[model samples]
Target: MAGPLQRVLMRSAASAMHRAKASEWHYGPGFDPQKAAAQYEALTMLVLASGAEIEWLTDADDGLADSVFTHDPSLMTDHGAIILAMGKALRRAEPGLHEAAYRRMEVPILGRIEHPGQVEGGDCVWVDSRTLAVGRGVRT
Candidate 1:
């Protein structure tokens, strides 16, 4: 899915990412929370400068270190958002967070991939408005 950034859903790094357990999250020894936060701030500023509207997800220390990756939890479409089920076991709760954000933002829910049908937004490639190609693998 390639398009101009008009609106985006983002979670700040102030929560889980700030206190991410490097071993659990598979982050390398080079991982630094402060640097990550600074980079996030820079990116946020860029997104704002681009005139895009950002809908932020609430930050909380829920031990979901990977929660800051909002894109993988849901897929946005012209109609509504498709709540995705994560392939990664640690990210299972992430979809619920996105769902809650959508409800708060008044964004409609098109459908969701159930327990047995796991799908990650990153593995989905939209060829057009209606054409979608889904890849299946370890991370799908």
Candidate 2:
């Protein structure tokens, strides 16, 4: 049997898809805003269907096109959550937004990475209870 997902974070793609230019992200072709919205709704429904309580980040409609991928801004552990710093300049605001949401949800924040150090949550993978492998590259 699959383990229960206690909580999950998600962002709506409506504003991001409708307001931002596709050229900003080099989305060259086949980018449909309507389709994107449909897919996003389907994906959110799937997450809910899996028995996870979702925390939708509704206030993050600041035209950050990549905001829908919430996993990149924070890392969750049994002890608490770590708000990460984005390596990409355009994505910098994401961490702060995530921090506010986590605070509202009463999720403990362990710490945050400051300037000169960069890590995206997507770049870190848990190997076991105590080990985490962090990727070192442009994004992390």
Candidate 3:
């Protein structure tokens, strides 16, 4: 989570976010798909301007509303990515998408958190080069 930005894996908002059912996804009433897609585009442009290589995951509408939040599906370490298991039932399919992306990019996978063991990338923090602090909470 530190150092220079080299590559980032992201999914396009138009793929799933734009077609997400706000209510089912627990999105607030004010959630607007069009605005979300526009914002995502703007953010993508900014990331591009920063000169970081962007690795896109997919453009297909997989009905994974929060799939755009790519940080939670996997953990990237110096060795490789650790595919995580989602705590949310609706998000169970997300990790596979990330694993596929890694395979496509030829990125090695160090490990995976299988069923009955849940670990979300968002719930982890790097303490140093070799230490990782993982928080246990509702979203973890």
Clashing pairs in 2: none
Candidates in order, TM-scores: namely 0.93, 0.90, 0.95
**Candidate 1 residue pairs in clash (backbone atoms < 3 Å):** none
Stretches off by above 4 angstroms in model 1 are none
**Model 2, 11-71: lDDT tens per residue?**
8877666666777765667777778878998998998999888997864468787888898
**Residue 140 miss distance in model 1 (angstroms):** 1.8
Predicted structure 1, TM vs. truth: 0.93
Model 1, position 60, has a per-residue lDDT of 73
Ordering by TM-score: 3, 1, 2
True lDDT of residue 66, candidate 2: 80
The model with the greatest lDDT is 3
Q: Write the per-residue lDDT of candidate 1 for residues 1-140, one digit (tens) a residue.
A: 56778998888886668778787788899999888888888988999999999998878777777887777899999989999999899899999999999999999999999988888988888887789888888877
Computed on alpha carbons, the lDDT of every model, listed in order, comes to: 0.86, 0.83, 0.90
Candidates 1 and 3, the one with greater TM-score: 3
Model 2 TM-score relative to the real fold: 0.90
CA shift of 42, model 1, Å: 1.1
